[model samples]
Target: MRLEQQPLSQVPEKAYHLPAGTAAAHGYDLEVTPESAGWGYSGLRVVTLAAAEEHAFSTGDDEVVVVPLSGAVSVEADGSHLDLAGRADVFAGPTDFAYLPPGTTATLLSERGGRFALCTARTDRHLPVRYGAAADVPVELRGAGRSSRQVRNFGTPDHLDAGAIIACEVITPDGNWSSYPAHKHDEASATESELEEIYYFEIAAGPQGQPGLGFFRTSSSPGHPIEITEEVHDRDVVLVPFGWHGPAVAAPGHAMYYLNVMAGPPHPAAEAQGGRAWLISDHPDQTWIRSTWADEQVDPRLTGERS
Candidate 1:
């Protein structure tokens, strides 16, 4: 039950993008605190819309999750049902994801400079919202090296894919270290529990911008460990649960882009689906991590999300 301490720039940027960790993302133009400032739920933040204004937002108490961690956009809640989508791993990667529920009152349309990562979850109730992403919902990337994949969304298959969300998109090579020892699904009593997490990062270097970003925290045991590898830019966020949540995002030759937003309270045998039942586990100490990264090679274009 940790990860309490938010303050990534105080949140207050109508049209702002300046958190340089990813070396001033060129085509990326980052933005990290939308509707969630350290987990409180204030003025409804998280903006990175490059040019296309129809302005009309309402929903201030929280309860929102408009995630699109990369490309595609076009929403219009109440504005007149005009949905267009792509993101959550390019519309289906890392286990498909996309939802904007709480009340409504929305309008976000992207022309071309689309690179999203918006997720709001506070809850109050806005009204008049929007979202549209029809056709081509076939994302596939079923594990290899470091695995766990399942994002199959067709058209609100049942909605509720996940909200106490623990997102993902990890590409760790170079020395390898993906979520080591550290463990804790927050805690929700029987039925699993405690889950309040968020970690956003995008790093790319190796032919020039070397030094890639790495190292994270939540450890002080199994031999006392607490380190934060300096060098992390591009929408930086480290809102972990508690101690023992180790080795997240490792880079030594560039190639690490993290996007993990999680929600807890389910799992532990409480039954009823048990959250997601650990999803997939076996990380006591893979001998130095990398348990099996043999050179790794998962990039079938890496963008369109397994089209």
Candidate 2:
């Protein structure tokens, strides 16, 4: 399935903001393929299964990582079997995952059903099937004060041995902001890499189990102008083909979590540098924000000092 690329001049206003259930297909709650996204790489799928149920698919030309959003899952691929000890929920902590190389058929079965995120990127390289332990993931607390957020670098270049996909998870406490300083990686140069990005979000509910919401923003960049500012909810996704995007803000009573998927062409200057680098340039006007973090302390909730 291929979709003709829409000229940037004619890109739809709402094309980047995919609301929950809007992109459902192939038995997945949400499916965003490179073809469907009008980009060359980066895709994501959110799937849910019942107890004892299974889902199977072929990797085709894309390498994939099976990340459990909730509950445990058993994965079988390329004659290899992996049991991911998933967490109770996203906020429960990092969960184990399975990486399936390209050109393989894989099956996922859960004794006690749950939701899973399939993060993918188109690539020609065929690596081996491997499992990533939750304990091995590097968790970083970035920024400070209201800008503080927790980042789970599970499938980043320095950590995982993969071809094109660079994925991770971020959690921003309620009323906080993340992905700040408004950065852009739309230009391929000595300082920046041109990568298309996908943000799949999940907001935590309020004390009474009320629905949660957050906000995301993206503004115009030099040659690639785009604009997006929307209230995002659980399962909502935002595509960043180009532009300066930042300050994903969690509402006053709702913490926000998002999975980031990115991929792009390799830099010619550094052929050995697999297409796994995440180089970005902060919006000049807001670059000064980084200096403020030196004086402020990280949010207590993220430092385990308080709940």
Candidate 3:
């Protein structure tokens, strides 16, 4: 990836689609900061540690959530210690997590080694450090048929109380699609909220352990026009500064998983509303797809049954 500064027109494609290892920084395999994204709030860092290894860092001005992608880990932050029971892989279901407020120092150690995702958001409000148990995460099955997907709401505004960040995980079965109907949240209004988003993906391997692949699309949205339709693989990332993004499709036999990190300024009309929310507007032409879901049965794979 080019590191030297260049005009957006000169590096537009590279700016949004980051292949594996292209965004690495600060000892992490993948790092996308608010500064790096040319945005103000959301960030994500992915790291893998060997058995008995330790990693430490200060939260600085960002409130962060430590999510394990695999293996177990123990986190110590703000005078508190918590053991996170992580999953075997992203396809293994939800895993516990730890939250650390800004300006705090923390350490993470894995007895058996693991891969972790640090989701962050720059904020002034300092909430207390806390642990989110895997069992407490709400898993919702959304859409139906080809659009069916599983959503694990762990750090979403309605689930975890944070200053600005809103996060969740989506699992789309092979040959299905998620993030459909093409939506945008690039405007701040009573019906929409402006939030920058980061999509970190992981594609489950094939039966013979071959690499997996998928696709992602982000198209123009009014004044905040942009476009990206790229083939994605394990550990790849897509950044949405402003645009309508959707139709993340997993190729046949390749299950897909993505961690979404989002954060933005509070809506002006929300001073009395008392909560940050994710409000979006779907593409007018594709909005009709939502109605079809009402008549279709959800894909059995997402209902805890084998496909």
What is each predicted model's overall lDDT from 0 to 1? Answer: 0.45, 0.90, 0.88
Candidate 1 lDDT by residue in tens digits, 29-84: 44333333344322113446665633345443433545555555666665455545
Please provide, for model 3 over 40-122, each residue's C-alpha lDDT reduced to its tens digit, 9 standing for 90 to 100. 88899998999999999999999999999999999999799999999999999999999999999999999999999999998
TM-scores of all models?
Answer: 0.30, 0.96, 0.94
Candidate that scores best on lDDT? 2
Report the CA-based lDDT of candidate 3 relative to the real structure. Answer: 0.88
Worst 10 residues of 2 by lDDT: 1-10
**Of models 1 and 3, which has the larger lDDT?**
3
lDDT of 2 at 164: 87
What ranking emerges by TM-score with the best candidate at the front? 2, 3, 1
Evaluate model 1: give its TM-score.
0.30
Per model, how many backbone clashes are there?
A: 53, 0, 0
Q: Please tell me which predicted candidate would have the highest TM-score against the true structure.
A: 2
Among all windows of ten consecutive residues in candidate 3, which has the lowest summed lDDT?
A: 1-10
